[model samples]
Target: MLELEKVTAAYSGSKVLFGVDITANKGEITCLVGRNGVGKSTTMKAIMGLVSTPSGDIKLDGKSIFTLPTYSRAKAGIGYVPQGREIFPQLTVKENILLGMEANPGVKEIPQEIFETFPILKEFLERRGGDLSGGQQQQLAIARAVVSKPKVLILDEPTEGIQPSVIQEIGRVITRLKKDMAILMVEQYLEFVLEVSDRCYVMEKGRISMSGRTDELDKDRLQQLLSM
Candidate 1:
């Protein structure tokens, strides 16, 4: 399991997260949901070591990773697919996927499983990443992350600006990926959250205000929390 215990983070002099607590277990799909500027993405950055957490601990399995740098954290099995699908625009789809291998030493080639899961990638291996549509780029981003064979995958707002049909495909891909590793995603779309998340944590003003199994949350109550 990957866990953040009372994690507090700041940017320059402004605090964004306050004693935030959440966990993502292997084989489960956990989601961090909240409105804009509520610190969902900040929480993801904190886990990935892109931001400093001066007052809390981040653990992978049972070990503390608070002091590890971003590259070290990736070596520790934390794969991050940041928002906006930050693929190398000038690189081919195949090259972009290969870039993830830098995190995992001794990995020589893209895994056959990745191609099996995202067949479209096989068809467009030579295409530049920037040439693909938003949905295709999203798939390539995910494929890049999983190719590193991390124990946990952190995705930030993956469905944003994606088409409905592509959203469905990404949802299916996430479901399948959860069987082997933990998936901790920050998402804004409520319907997608309700469908894909096994557990949900609702963040408000830099803190977690509500969390529970997806089936346990009453839709009306959830709607109210999200709207607040």
Candidate 2:
């Protein structure tokens, strides 16, 4: 339900993304895979309207949202768990999650199902967000996003610095999310991305160089492009 059409973005006058195009459909997972500094994250930032761009069209459910502010984008059903799982350090687990509700308009109550996807959060409802382990914080980040009940979810490297078991848990949660939300991610874990995503886009030098159905991807070609 999200489309990035020939997007080009930059800092000051220097551009990074050049005609970058990617799409994520409802109840599907679309992944962006690339080595470091290839503009994968930049693409997401553009979609989120975190950076002003010279040209592009970013649409959510067929509505033009490119010129909107980041807050407006979040209100329009985009939930983003950025790289590093930027949870509020001092806020109690319950309080941290409540912040997500700001994105909601008429919603009056928290979803009990938020705890269903993340039972760990229920037990530590009063704990400080910074006091939790990395995995717990990541889970909290995802749970916080879920509290908003977004139509599209964008996770930036959810597995970057966590234990294997938590990574597995995150994988399971994402699997379940794909049953409803349009999920998109920029991840370094190729196997994880392939296992969870329906389609993959490989970026190189700030552009999509290869992409296809995850199961049919050419491993060698992807490996070569990733090494560049």
Best by lDDT: 1
Candidate 2 C-alpha RMSD relative to the actual structure: 1.1
Clashing pairs in 2: none
Q: In model 2, state the lDDT of residue 222.
A: 80
lDDT tens per residue, model 1, 53-156: 77899999889988998999998888899999998999999999999988898689889989988899999999999999999999999999989888899999
Give me the runs in candidate 2 sitting further than 4 Å from their true place. Answer: none
lDDT by residue (tens digit), candidate 2, 156-219 = 9999999989999999998899777899999998778877889899998878988888889998
TM-scores for all candidates?
0.97, 0.97
Which residue pairs show backbone clashes in model 1? none
